[model samples]
Target: MMKKIIFALLVLVATSASAQNGITNDFRFGQGEDSLRCIETITIVNVNLNNKDYATAYTAWKTIFNEFPVARVDTYTNGVKLLNELIKKESDPAKKSEYVKELMNVYDQQIKYLDKLQEITKSKLSAGNILGKKALSYIQYYNNAPVDTIYSMLAKSVEMEKGQSEYAVTERFMKYSALKYKQDKSHGEQIIEDYLNASIYIVEVLDKYHASIERSEKKYQEEGNPRDSLNAIGYGKMIDASRISKSNIDAYFINSGAASCEDLSKIYAPTLEANKDNIEYLNKVLSVMSMLKCTNEDTYLTAAEYALAIEPTAKAAMGCGYRYYKKGEIDRALEFFDQAIELETSITTKAELCYKVGLIHFSLNNYGKARAYANKALGFNNKYGQPHILIAQCYGAANKWSEDDVMNACTYYLCLDRLDRAKAVDPSSKREADKLIAIYSKHTPKVEDLFMRGYEAGRSVKIGGWINETTKIR
Candidate 1:
């Protein structure tokens, strides 16, 4: 046991002496005749690091870090690990802050020396990735770090990588901007700009991931088997990241209070006028304005006009429709709603547009036109319950009935049928449909009233005029 202890002490002394000599000589590989000494120090540092002996690792690590900062990529990579361990083990706040600063420096050095090291060692480390690591570390460890400083680091990282930016980095960029906006309202424009950039990048990443997933699914279906495990795992991770990023961004915007109609108009009004000819900018402004429900504002109208003139889209048409609808220009509103339905390819969106037209007709008391529009909505989406209720309302209106008891009472039967259909088709409208059904069932022709009309229960009757629907006597 004494021999073993003596041997261990001797090895330790030799390692310490070797590290000291390397530091004294400023040994660096490819620098001079001390190449072997640099290699020996690197091995010693790596062995200690691998064994979780960060303290011992730091002895040789510091020598290489100071004397040969550009010796190898691992010189910085392993240095990060060593310093982080030091930070964790440190009990003093000042010392921990120093260690944290050193860790950040290590990342910066890695980026500075990355290209040269890549030339020498063929490493794949990118400047963006290094910036991302530094930014993430600052966010996690340095609570007192300047928000702008951290945001700048993340912004540069995102700019460098764009669609390839890390999900966490993009998410953090938005969150930090939101935090800054809350702290200082003067930074509102900057916050909006950051959110736009982050949203664009996130959407691009999501599109790529969704396309990849679709391709994978297609291949799997064609082959009647699963994709390779690595591809499957990669797609799963990307999809999960996209979902999380989307949710985070959505929630951040919804809760940010900066996206309110008044705030959005204030932020986008000037931007819209300055970039009137920039179609892409106009589209972005329109999207944000519409999302914040600022469609009633002049900024929204200006954006909609510019965007529609540049290139009409379903959304642009819908904006115009709402503008006209608000002005009580029923014909113009219907025209734009029709355009929106034609431009829209999504069945659900088309259904909604048709339903809006139906609402306009219902408000005008044009029962025939309203029913036609409602039927058109149902054709697009048969499960749309609101249209069914609208049609029932059109039939149940006082104008649809007359003073003649039998004819007036018969309208209720048709109204009840429409309401029942609504309840059956749309679970969301069940309660409303039930209430309307109860109110209208009492208005249905009583057995005695049907008898007075020379009719009996279960006899077919055609109630003509606006409501031309045929129903059986109750």
Candidate 2:
């Protein structure tokens, strides 16, 4: 036992001397001595950490973290693990919190030292990344911390990192924002701003990942099926993360009830007058209002008009079109819808614009124009079920323009045909298509009417007027 104690003490002295030497040479950047010392200390720290010897690792880790903080990124990462283990073993809550605070300080030191080291080593350790790790630490270990304090850290981290933020940080940031809103109604605008900022950043990240996936897919095809060069797995994880973040954030907003039209009106009305001329602010407000389906509110019109006056993009044009359409002004709505469709370049967006225009024409009782516009939408997106349903409704309403009972009943056949097309092309609309098919089947030309019109059940007949579709008499 005496020999074992002496051996352990000798090992401890050797380790301490080595780490002290590393601390002394930490300031000598680009020197062989400094590099050797850093490597030596790092190896020792990592070995202890890897072996789950947190007590031993913590001593060496602190030396490297404080002395050669920027020498290796692993110092901070490994320090986190070591501190977490120490905190977990502590029975006292206060001591655990102190360890958590030390962990946070380690992250802060990383940001400070990494920035300096980047100038020397050309490393890519960003301040935003360090800040993100700090925020995550607070969330993971300091859950009992003050909400405002945690929220501020998360908000700053998100602002600094933007689209490069960690998925977990974004999620926690929104949760705190919601909590803050519930605790104090006065912070409603801040909550909205936080949500919008997080949403925009999430969308940007998703767009980047989608673009990467596209490039990867193209590379995979060009590589002739070996498939090893494909970054599909990497990009796929990013895509899934973005999607889940979006869905979770959206659900949080909806369940919070803070984004409802009534809430938004109360929140945004005062700010609107002040920011009416602030084009960027107006656009953001209009976007959020539109996303929350508050287009019918007066605030939406105000914001839309402000945004349009500054810049007439597809978004503003669509807002104006929907506003007028809701007011029963079909001509004005059609004009704006056309402008929106012309201004938009995305195929999916164009399809939606065309569908909106078709709906307006249909509402105006212009069956021919509605059918034409609906077909235009299909040309852009062949699988667009809404346009197909709109066209069917137009055909069903065409009976109002028919004079004879036989012709009126025949319009239902045309309507049913379009409904069938909808089901065939878009499986998402299958249930609705089947329900409409059952209802419209009863309206098909009666046997007596068909016979009177000199039409047999299997005989093909030309439907005149606006609808030029041919259908077999049923």
Candidate 1: where is the Cα deviation over 4 Å? 1-28, 92-94, 120-124, 211-227, 269-275, 290-298, 312-474
Candidate 2 lDDT by residue in tens digits, 1-474: 644643443443333223333224443212344444555666678778889888888888887776666565677778888998999899998988788889989888777666555654555777876787787778787657788887888888898889788777787788888877877878777888888887767766765665676677688777755463457657766656665677687777767767788878887888998997888888787768766778888888878777788888777887887788778886797788799899876655577678877876777787788888999998876655778888888878766546787777887887888888887666667788888889899888778767876888778877777677788776
Please list the residue runs of candidate 2 whose C-alpha ends up more than 4 Å from where it truly belongs after superposition: 1-35, 46-59, 81-99, 120-123, 224-230, 266-276, 329-474
TM-scores, all candidates, are: 0.58, 0.64
lDDT by candidate, in order shown = 0.75, 0.75
> RMSD of candidate 2 to the true fold?
9.6
Q: Write the per-residue lDDT of candidate 1 for residues 349-458, one digit (tens) a residue.
A: 57767887888888888778888989998886665678999988988884345668667778887787788888666665788899999898888867876777698877
Best by lDDT: 1
Candidate 1: C-alpha lDDT: 0.75
What clash pairs does model 2 have?
none
Top TM-score: which candidate number? 2
RMSD in Å for candidate 1, one decimal?
12.1
